[model samples]
Target: MRSKGERLRRRRSAGSRLSTGSASELQQYSELLHASPTNPYAPFDSKIDWEVARWAKLRGPGSNAMTELLKIEGVCDSLGLSFKDTDALNRMIDNLPGRPAFKREEVVIADEAFEVYHRDVIECIRALYGDPEFAKDLILLPERHYADADKTIRMYSDMHTGKWWWNTQKAVERETPGATIVPVIISSDKTQVTLFGNKTAYPIYMTIGNLPKEIRRKPSQGGHVLLGYLPTTRLEHIVNKASRRRTLANLFHSCVSRILRPLKKAGEFGVPMASGDGIYRRLHPIFATFVGDYPEQLLVTGIKTGECPKCPVPHNELGEYGDRDKLRDIEQVLNALSSITDGNPLVFVKACAAAGIKPVQHPFWEGLPYVDIFQTITPDILHQLYQGVMKHIISWVTKACGAAEVDARCRRFPPNHSIRLFTKGISTLSRVTGREHSQMCQILLGLVVDVCLPDGHSTATLIKAVRAILDFCYLAQYPAHTDETLNHLDEALQQFHQAKHIFVLLGIRSDFNIPKLHSLLHYIASIKCFGTTDNYNTEYTERLHIDFTKDAYRATNHKDEYPQMTKWLTRREKVLRHEKYIKWRVAGCPPPDVPQTDGMPDPRDLGSRPHLRMTRHPTVKAVPVSTVKLQYGAQFFEAAFARFVVQYHEPRWTAFQVEQAAANIYLPFQRLPVFHKIKFWIKDPFHRGLGSETSDAVHCSSIWA
Candidate 1:
């Protein structure tokens, strides 16, 4: 085998030949090649190097190579067989290249201690930029305007297509010409590490809008980076309840501010970075969006639980919808926070309460440029819509129409290919999820069809209100939206508002002062500013919790697992990045080229045309016709098969002729092939052709019934 130095020289020579696109790109690449710790690839030159790489690649989920080797040794000892030593494995892993260490910082609030673990934000950004896999799908510039053949402006679909991106691009260009705006998206959520225990992890994740949403949403793609894991403390040390809450909020803001401090200067002064297209650009990393559920939103913005995070709407008037209130001004909030300088906690709390915010000394977004903290709080379909609004609607409607009757209707509802069958009814479900709420929405209106209401209330009005809310829910989730669809969305909300008083008259709800209901009023404005709801949906971030937090925690011992989890995550990332580098080298490290945009079929243009698909092998190779009828519940199988045969043989056959031919026709084979399920794929009309394949399966097995 070649020596390590020889392998390094050969790899560098080959990489140098790849086109750099410009002088800036060449300079950056040269620096990366010579840098001590920032080099993109590691040289595998010996038997031990190959062994380590193989071990990293073959490790199982929530496990390391060392653990697996130890297990193997135990099994071999039991069988009287010899096994190799694991010291070499451990040594090789430790010596692996390009592994960044985590920093542990101790934070104190209200005389209580907490731990915050994090990595360098700028270093993480550079690592992501240097990855070759992202280069294939990176979107570097804003798509300000795009029109169709009819000259009609299309709806916003991607993050770059939104007005916020375009406005920020223009602003940055004015300040520093030829500078690129990198839209940074940050998300954080607390998740339980174990199923039965109270142990939990609060992880902060970061990604960029420079990548396509299709790529950024998938956790396996490594597009979403784990910035840090915050301490999950209840702060029981503080005796006063109010003081404890204030201290917890302050701790959160302080930890987040520390993690994101690098962006403050980088957002104003451009940093030189190499783009996916082999071109160097002066990139300004702006904090453009924050994705989280309602509780996190309140915590991040320093707002109380009952108030709107995006606007100045009063808590009591949230149910009354009409003209939108003014947006929360950051400067005004800061001034309010600074108004009381006596350092008295009571006076500070009063000043913040007057401003409708919590007593947070400094919010995470205090110094970030071109970012409206309120606007950054995006719409969450999971918590706000499905879990929040839909849950309330179900409860109100069930009470008004009687739960027994609704449960009977739900049990009697037929099975569908697209909609889930809630066999036990939704009334008894303890903790319903967003997915269950979605399935319930499909059959909600059907359950109340022509059903009478109690108290002589109008059933039509209830049906109308439910229908309008469902319409709004479905429309708000559209992958793409236009001027016309946005108007329809507004109309749906207005219709709901006009018909919502039926619940009050029926004594189901005293008032409509629901914050979730009020949130619907701002969907149009949010969509216009930040593209569609899916761009920052909390559902994607919730999915990331499994890979980034829960799984990482599982790979560690119960005591002080934060450091172990962070280190495991770093090693996993390094392994994946090195795999990508090896693949690129094997492919000859081709120069990056501009993506072809013309002549590509637009997904929106392709209407809802479904194509049937099935397995290549038959589910049942030889099942008798009689068996199919008796076991599979196909009572009219013979008649249906005869009619199909007659229609296939004779065009425009009458029913009478079909019946006559059915009597004469006989089975050519005693046994017939059976397929248990069939799938249908329809092209989605949004988000271009990237994520447009909508599929549903129909199972024909008797057990499914």
Candidate 2:
């Protein structure tokens, strides 16, 4: 009898053979490309004639295996193209004399290059589908789209750099997530044109990043690829040549409107435009405007103002504007945009030149049929929070305060006990807070407890102000509380501005200006107007670009970088799709659930403590409180140095947990003996508050008073 391992191997081998045989059978159903029966080695262009003949000779005379696959009837068909058997052809090509290289001189025109790729990309897109839930619901219509453009330099040589890109959308649903489908490349032969406020024409390059279904079928078998490049061109190439003023908005409108016109027409088709493999996608107009960053928005929209383009108030040079009398509303913003004369460059330019309020010149957004400036522009939350405020404030805190605290404490303790702040700086802050501004408020409150900072200290005040804004972001979800939160945030902002000299007092430089520190202010009003902070956030879009950057590191050809990006995107999508399919299969037939284990009963029950029912859990027995992590309403505090004692667990209460405690349990970290009951939402602690002690007893308010 064969060994069990040998029997298993034989079974696996038989299964593989069966699968391969079935795949071949399925390929027979493909008629277009597979049944063409043309010579595979035939060359379409004279440029590859020498290579073609060598391939024929390598296959040996009359073997017919090396016949040009391209010339095969129906072989070029989308369905047939995917099923082509390239093993024989690949083997033949591998034995050729030298590796293939790009012939740049033979490159097609940018417009022609874009069309060839766009046609195939559109075909592929038509085959895939979007989340039906997102498409059907009007509320979710805004969620289905995000538009942002970024330029990355592709080096052909040390001195020669080219840029190209195409607009595309990625599908995200719980079941089949992260499917990036490429859209058409919007490029033209006349790539450069001067726009309003520009002295020269800016060159245009639109490269669609998508991979053929054939290539994407099995990405893991080989190294990842980045191959779908429409063409390469430069932005500054035309800008450098133009000697007259050009408006960026005009150029964007002229180019994009033309591109969208075709797509707008395509949306009328009743048949799901693109459907295959049980997935379908629709070509629809984008609703949200999620651009790369503030500068890009300013450039693209022809709005020179550094403040948010949608702000109703006239933002100052410092990008700071807040008026109690003139709170932001859609009506006021529309009136301001309407003041800019349509198509009259002189009038718009003169309006922009005025100091207080500048007029928006973009014809595409400002007074377009039903759309208003408020709907067209949105503040980038990622840049405002993570890259901007969180990063800057953390830097200021570390340099001016955290470092001092660390140094002061380090010398007093042993090397092992030496205190250090979060080593990753703002990144650590971001990870802890994430999208929850309330959680950030918790972290900020922790800083006070961690460093033993007094409540009235300037640094403490700054943190408070920062937390106030974060809390506003967190609590803004409640429509009833939105105005209240905004008011609190305004107060916090004022306090922070008043304490500007505090940074200097803490040894920060004198040149620190409030305007530079106030970029976060622009996002607040917009948040109230938009109903959520996520509406304008670039967190997802920026993350996608980050993935692109990381994948680009694998590219060997610096000159032709677009193809590498396309290949990476395709491979990533394929991997995600395969994973989704596997998950779907598993979901249909779920594994048996593991038996549940009984957890140890509360220790108090096993012990002689008959009073355990008085509290949710047992309170630590008379132990000194090393760190008092307390929550009172939305307020959260984690104090490492503040001292108190575990008197008793306060019995469950509807609104508050009052603890009667003795002060100065630890001499160095002592606090007032006056007992207090902390009030906070009950559900909050379960979600975020971990390792906190339940109050042992109800504090007597009258006794403390």
Candidate 3:
């Protein structure tokens, strides 16, 4: 006889093949996508899920961690209507896996890790129903109803909470000494029988649109699934707690009466068990920025190799000139991912990789992280990869901070002073304790700049970072990565017109002195007003931080700056294809217009020495060519470095890339051959923070302070 696992795998494979034929049945499986979503379909885009799913499949077992990370970001972006950053992502990652037994193909989790333990239920269900029955039931599963989000337990027909949800009154009635339904609905998505005192019935409700593709009448093969089940009273109590609504306040704009669902005494959904994991996450947004593990020196980009030179793993497998081992480790982790029947597989393999114990070392423990073997592995990789786990950490952090609503706690719409409070707190904390302002700045910017996108414009915060730091200079420095940062930047830029003046008020930007940038901004407005059709709502090139809603908001109010930009317009630049910054895709080439040498030319100083400085330059025509865009996943740092070099009479182009499979992307400027040519750059280990505002201010401040 095949082992139980093989039996289950065989059953699932057949079930999948059977289920694939019917489009309706396949469509029903999408509920699984929404149930345990990596993100909500933001901007009404379903492709994001496919992108996330593709990433997960490619990354292997580690892909689940990536999946969870994506889910956290997607959840935050879709639900809160905000963004996050890498620092915030790290904090959130640390908070997960708080319970036990995690997996990928969850039907429902009936225990401590009910939130993630749905696969067990699914497995049990598959075992109960033969492969065909299992496949058919998946077709009948409900379409993901966003309105009922708090209702369903993602993967499992009814996760533990789902079981409780299905048998809510039954669980209440059974007060029965020991009774729990072995989820027939879970193990196989195609089946829907739950054991209620040996009488199996499809107790769960199903919505109209999402249903099984095929309907099966015969029970076939094993008529009843036998589960040598045990009932635990302690677990029963826990399920009751887990059954509590997920963010009632968030879900229901109107408050629910205490009589309907009693609130926990601690005023939370659940109480802390041992050490509360996310205190850092909960508090850090208020404090601002995380202590990022920014390496003091270059990452061992295959030059030094990921292997501990002496430890003797084959270093050749990892590509030279980059941390290919990290990539290999990432791939290895993805491949090994099984459901969390044991535990977090990503963390498990990560520990192995960090300790130099490759896949061959713990072959059986490939995708599952069981404590027996996992305990033996070193925790360094598990430790380092935490940063990459929660993608939009910053946005969540800002929200959590705002959730405190400390400044105007009870108001319907609080002042939303989270950023200002964080900045003020940092200033206060730094001055009183003589904390290094640079370090403090680094933490804040790591969350802000490194995490968020579109650098430093008012759109930095997912919790509306723009309105909070009105008229501030944009903080454009790269900080640590997290989930919310990129999401927040995208969302904020989507609503750029709403955040613009606030950025200016914060003095984050010098109003464009060149009419070219202004005209570009105007053209962007016109395109927004008109339509780019294909790339409509695309986030690139024309993303401006403008919020037209404010009562007192106004443009920079200087025609001199506006009209003066005519020169840049005159530069014969028709470089429109960089909208998505695609290289090979677009046709035609306009020499990539290097940013003009002039600094922020004030409208007031316009025809003065600053103005004369531009026209009166020695007749050296133009400077010699430097480098072109080498491929990079990182553009923020290189973009800044490129401009920095020209200011100090230096020239170099830098590209960013992933390092050691770590969350942090490397600028690798110092690694380039023309590294010496980047004279205008700065290292800033101490911390001014992320984005243009902090970059401009702290660079100015560090020079002064």
Indicate which candidate wins on TM-score: 1
Candidate No. with top lDDT:
1
TM-score, one value per model:
0.82, 0.43, 0.17
lDDT per residue as tens, model 2, 1-705: 222223322432211111111211112212212322343222111214423333333223332343455547774453233223334433433332221111121222212222211223223333222211112211111111111122121111100010111111212112122222232222221211113322211222222213221111222211122212223233343454332124333444443343333333332221233221223333332222323455555544444444544434444434243442232355544454455647675655554544223343333333322233343344455555555555555556556546556344333432121123333333334334334432233344444334543334555555554565445344433222233455665676666555555555666546433322444464444443333443334443433332334343233244444444344344334333322222323344311121111122322122233322343333333322322323222122222222122323323432222222222224453232323432222222444322122423332232112
Clashes of each: 0, 38, 110
Candidate 1, 1-705: lDDT as tens digits: 222223322433211222356533223443443423432333444334443445543354334454575477355354332223444443444455553467999887766678999988877776566555566676666664444545365567788778788678767766766656788999999999998979989999998888888777766556788899998998887899988888888899989998999998998987777754465666788999999988899999988888888898888999987665358877778777776577787887787887789878877888788888888888889999999999899998889878888888889877688888877887888878889888899999998788888767788999999999999999999978887888899999999999999998998888888878888888888888788998899999999998888878877887889988887777666555445444344445543332211123333333534478789998888888888888898878888988899989996989899889888888787788998888888665665556447788887865434
Please report how far candidate 1 places residue 44 from its true position, in Å: 5.2
The per-residue C-alpha lDDT of model 2 at residue 218 equals: 21
Segments in model 2 whose C-alpha atoms lie over 4 Å from true places: 1-286, 312-321, 324-348, 351-369, 398-403, 406-525, 528-531, 546-556, 567-705
Q: Candidates ranked by lDDT, best first?
A: 1, 2, 3
Question: Please, what are the lDDT tens digits per residue for candidate 3 over residues 608-654?
Answer: 32211122333222322232233222335455554554434522323
Candidate scoring better on TM-score of 2 and 3: 2
Against the hidden true structure, what lDDT does model 2 obtain?
Answer: 0.33
Pairs in clash, predicted candidate 1: none
Which stretches of candidate 1 lie above 4 Å from their native place? 1-87, 146-154, 340-350, 590-623, 626-669, 672-676, 679-692, 699-705
